[model samples]
Target: MCVADGGVKTDRLSPAMVDKLTFLRGVGKQFWDLTDARIVNRNITMLRLGTLLLLCGSVFANELTINKIEDAAKAGQFTNIKIGNIQVPAGQTLHLKGLKAGTKIDFVGKVTFGFKQWEGPLIKIEGKGITVTGSPGHVIDCDGKRWWDGKGGNGGTTKPKFFAARLTDSSISNLNVKNLPVHGFSINSCQKLAITGVNIDVSSGDYANGAHNTDGFDVGSSSDIQIKNCNVKNQDDCLAINSGKNILFQGNTCSGGHGISIGSVGARKDNVVQGVIIKDNVVMKSTNGIRVKTVLNAVGSVSDVTFENIKLVDISKVGITVQGNYLNGGPKGEPTGGVPIRDLTIKNVYGNVLPKGTNILVWVKNASNWKFAFRTLWEVKDKIWRRTIKQDSDAQWRGPGQCFADHPQPRATRFTFP
Candidate 1:
């Protein structure tokens, strides 16, 4: 119930929450009588309202420590509930029915181990300014081996995404996510969100099973978000930023995934992603880096994005690519032209490559007025450009203006002079 020392109490539930405890008791007509309050005297109602207000004022008088959730979840008004030092069980979901401001939840132990296609998010928080953090060295073990046969979202075992949805003004940090059944985390409709200092290790899916598409962080329709100081070593896109404004992603380490992308946009359905910055991140041995691809036929505007100071090593394909008219190769290499890309910048990127026949340093199509600056583009055609494309001896083989030449498109050609 309480943990206190030296006149400083750490955690307790609100008294206003305790006042509502009477409502949870006494079933049938009495429950409705307290909840409905249709027949109560107006003066009595005013007195109860005043009492509730006073209780609320006293709720946070000391830090409200909640270790036992079975008792706290029973409270109706979840305003100002501070959850600290709590160990939750498997197959459990904490629902923030109607949370209010100043609600802080601290996760004390490892998350419940899960397998099978259970309806989840292990933890769900709502309302304003909610903070859910795990103790240092905490883990959310999905027991992915149970579901990972390398076919993640492509239909192996039904895998539930970690943190299925996050509302606004929240932070979930300091945890290790190991072997997710499917996608790791999906951030939804949360403004001013910060997901920092977390690790997602789906590498076990790489060899033991066929880990298909285990994307790390999927951001959709949210704003003012920052995902930094994190590591994602999985099979698919490290960060799939769908639709948002003013996003900041930096100081992250990623490998074995699509290196930091924006879009697959306007493909399934289009949305706007504006004012994004992907800088100072290390991408290792990925399929691509600093990419923005749109659906072939979908309609949307993705603009005002900047990628700078990105480092890549042993990557297999495009060093930096922005293409709109994209078509993935199936058994027959079919092309699907569904979406378009626009208004992007990729700068200060230095990397190695396969033969020019294998990797495209920078590729673009079906976008307008995009800029590529300070790119030391590399191609190993004769293994010359891999060293210096602008060498005096290689001038004959270099495209115009060294690396600043327009992409031989009718429109971009006007920007570069012969």
Candidate 2:
């Protein structure tokens, strides 16, 4: 029996039903006093619903049986259907053709990740304004162990991306994705997309082999996108924004990854990323806290960005960085003037390094008048840069904690570059 919102739907019982009801009633009597009255009342409602349904018709009993979600999907029918076990093995993709505009499809069982030679987006939604929600115990499990040689999505025997959502105006939430052979989630060409409350659990393979580039989420070429309240445990950037605008990331937990990043920008043929807000997030034992990166010779511009209220624990590398040339050892590297970044801010941010070194606080080149003021960027400068920390004991600032021994308090700094 399924009771949802005071409506009872049941498997009609006959003499068999009466017998089972009697048996259940006898079982209920044993614990009736201890059970919640509401639950008992619901059970009684279920019994009554069952009795009425049986008398109404025998066909009612057949309605409760499970059916394939893909079957209805094959016919483009949107119904309240329950799928038990569905498999999309390698060499086959489940295509939902001509999707309804506002359809709600729920998966109860595992959406097994297919192992293949090309990229695997086990599930791809090619429609507009749809929602793909997962309940408890439902997983899009990629058998990443088969391909976790540490090279990740970069190279290997064709690891599949776990989930991909394309087009616009969608909300995908409450899903647990695990063991991605390569990158876990990819958002492409989406406008106004919100991905929340999702868990990316790839921490298992970080040490199991040498998990190299297993990024949890990679957002590319989308505008007005927000990803928040999610947990990513992997080897590469917890979230890598390749290209997008007005992208906001907040309230997330990232551990065992390359922290949160923007760019590897201009890697795309024709795309640029701007207007990013990374706020209220926690980074744990990751490589870097908050960063923006661009290739040495790429032509693009990243401007108007902010990283605020981020808490870092045992970060192994730099605290916050903005660099157009990522190949160099530091953000202050000679700028080729390829992709110019401007209007940056790091406000109310705090981080602690785990020994090795905390490199440059903020670095930029090929931009005029950059400011890291907490409140706002009042003036824009050109072709020069300046970095200020609360106090640096040594001119060399040797390696993170060794130099800034007692500066535990949070401080705001600004970088103005020429």
lDDT of each: 0.61, 0.65
Considering every candidate listed, which one attains the maximal lDDT? 2
lDDT of 2 by residue, 115-174 (tens): 667776666666666666675666767767877776665566666666677847778788
* 324-360 per-residue lDDT for model 1 (tens digits): 5444421111113233344566666555433331233
Top TM-score model: 2
lDDT of 1 at 346: 69
Model 2 residue 45 CA deviation in Å: 21
Q: Model 1, which residues run further than 4 Å from truth?
A: 1-94, 268-270, 327-338, 354-364, 375-418
Worst 10 residues of 1 by lDDT: 409-418
Question: What is every candidate's alpha-carbon RMSD to the true fold?
Answer: 11.5, 9.2
